[model samples]
Target chain A: MQYKDYYKILGVERGAGQDDIKKAYRRLARKYHPDVSKEPDAEEHFKEVGEAYEVLKDPEKRAAYDQLGSQWQTGEQFRPPPDWNAGYEYSGGFSGDDAAAYSDFFESLFGFAGRAKTGSTGAGFHAQGQDTHARILIDLEDAYRGATRSISLRHPQLDATGHVALRERQLNVNIPKGVYAGQHIRLKGQGESGMGDGQAGDLYLEIGFNPHSIYRVDGKDVYIDLPVTPWEAALGEQVTVPTPVGKVNMKIPPGSTQGKQMRLKGKGIPAKVAGDFYVVLQIAVPPADTDTARKAYETLKQAAGFNPRQHLEKQS
Target chain B: MKNHDSAPTLNGEVLEDYCLSLQQLCHGATAEPEFILQLVEYEVLVPQGGQEAEWRFRAEDLARLRRAQRLTRDFELDLSALALVMQLLDELMELRGSG
Candidate 1:
């Protein structure tokens, strides 16, 4: 694993005081907090900052880390000297459920084996597994119809040697139909494995939809732009509109104009309180390139006595 | 007609209509009841009943309280300050969502 310069990550000096480190951490955390930050790499940077703070906040962990010598370069292949942490006592053990968010470098040093909470479950030291969160992207059709997705998760495992190792586990998750964006699907007993016979924590999967070329979805509502000939828009006509389910014959009311929206109720994502699908009519005017088409247009323009720019002229 | 009943089905229930009891909210957030009670005290989460046993929480309550808890733990902010932070963040998210 490459060496991480925690000091550089936090923008602090080697001899920086604990107060300085704490202030730096607070400032950086506020700036890069994933919820508020709009930066593209905000979450990754936030995790890195948190990991750096995790090591530096505690003096014991910091002392051990400093003993590695400041001369070492960041991203340089690093292996801790045996017994580097021999003298120091890690009083404040890893207590948070976010150990999985920490890097492998952090795990190699302060991971379970040498840390206070290492396999020492002792008798009656049971603990439930940590709840894991992930985002699942599915096609719009998947939301209309349920789908089974295979997802992989990395979790800390307690091996026979009492070493903390990250294990990749895969589970086939069933995504229920009509799941809207930003909604979560809870899968019981599917997160990190519980320690010492405790019940496993549930996995929370946030649903997101892949961008669809033809349809825009909000909640359960779906929208599509339907192209209609100018003649069809001018006169009422029975048209076939494509919906998530399939094509259905729809009636275009008389006097329908461009940018008119028609709602097809109960035709959206199928579910209780089903949302409506909207069809926005876009008038497609025929080009008068050919002589026959020009003659037809000329005949209609003279006979119809319609001034399309009357509204624009009024507005100006 | 097609026979596809052999496939295992997954039933997903939407967290609407005052769903999610207090206990489930606590479990989902991996937070203690005491902290949530404090949130209720600070007006962060307002449940129906005064008594803890009769109190109920919505899925939104779970999400907001968990967000508050994470911010507080990560930034070491107090509940009241974090409540304001949560409020601003909520407004920002709504604006971004609409824009």
Candidate 2:
């Protein structure tokens, strides 16, 4: 067995406080949870993180691990000394279900089979199979108008010869309208095969949008930065703006301030539930290059005595 | 097996140039020749089979293989994880370029 550094795995220091350890574990657990995280190896990494937290969260287990000392490096061949855990009294009795879930190495050090005094009955006859989870990235436009995509997936198939073979299969999935990022869509009877006569579990597909070039998504609302000339912002004008659906004429209110947001009802991504589109005004100052343009800017700068920093001077 | 010593120097003008033979690449990667050959068998790596044993490798491909090897050996990341990382990185880069 290799020496595993539980503290390093959790990104916490060896002498960290109990509260800090608990906080870090909760944050990481939520991040790497199979349902939420997009990081690769989330499942395996999440398992390792959970196992590390399970041992570190308890003072008794932590003390036993610390006894191993700093001399043993990570991944080093390790075997616990005989009677190493001679005196520590464990407050909470060991649970076999947790032990079975953990690695054999962890089990050898602190395993307690038939220790649960409750004598809890195992999963009864109708045990639903564990749900399989996957995240699918879709185009932003697809959310506005629902789309059906044929996706290809590759899985390892165990043949009759016991050798693993690679197989490719296609699945047609219905992308619901108005599905936001981090939201999940459940596909019935598409998960891992069930044991015995049990029914198969569901496949949860978490939806994520491919970042858009012109738009940004914030929860249910969509925000777009629209650049307008200084004159257009000062004196209102009706201009065409592009949305996911199509281009529409939008009016800029007179004396519109820069960064002022305007809402267009039901113009954003049209999921089963619709969201509103927001346009943020950005006033662009024209750079004078030609002589006439320079003179025009000079006249405007002289006539329009708009001191942008008047408020700052007043405060001073 | 064409010796690495006998291989001519490439001027590096081309977008991608095959610098070393398949054997040299395997040895350089500290991987088995057969394991590298599996990529060729899968058409992941295109190699001309004959007495000359002509093998072509793009700079991008060489870099990807190096990264793949690092994920496997250094990080102990499994193959599925490596594939997912590659896909995610590609999508991220593509999104950035488009933006």
For candidate 1, write residues B17-47 as lDDT tens digits: 3566678778887889889888888888888
Global fold similarity of model 1 (TM-score): 0.79
Worst 10 residues of 2 chain A by lDDT: A112-121
> What is model 2's DockQ versus the real complex?
0.01
In model 1, the runs with Cα more than 4 Å from the true position are A15-20, A113-119, A124-133, A192-197, A225-240, A249-260, A280-316, B1-17, B41-51
- Cα lDDT for residue A209, candidate 2: 82
lDDT of each residue in A70-143, candidate 1, tens digit only: 98888999888878778777665565776677777888788764453656678777789866667778888888
lDDT of 2 by residue, A171-204 (tens): 6676756777656565666655455567765555
- Tens-digit lDDT string for candidate 2 (B13-85): 1122354477645533445667556555544455544533677554334444554564454334555665666
lDDT of 1 at A114: 49
> How well does candidate 1 reproduce the true complex, by DockQ?
0.26
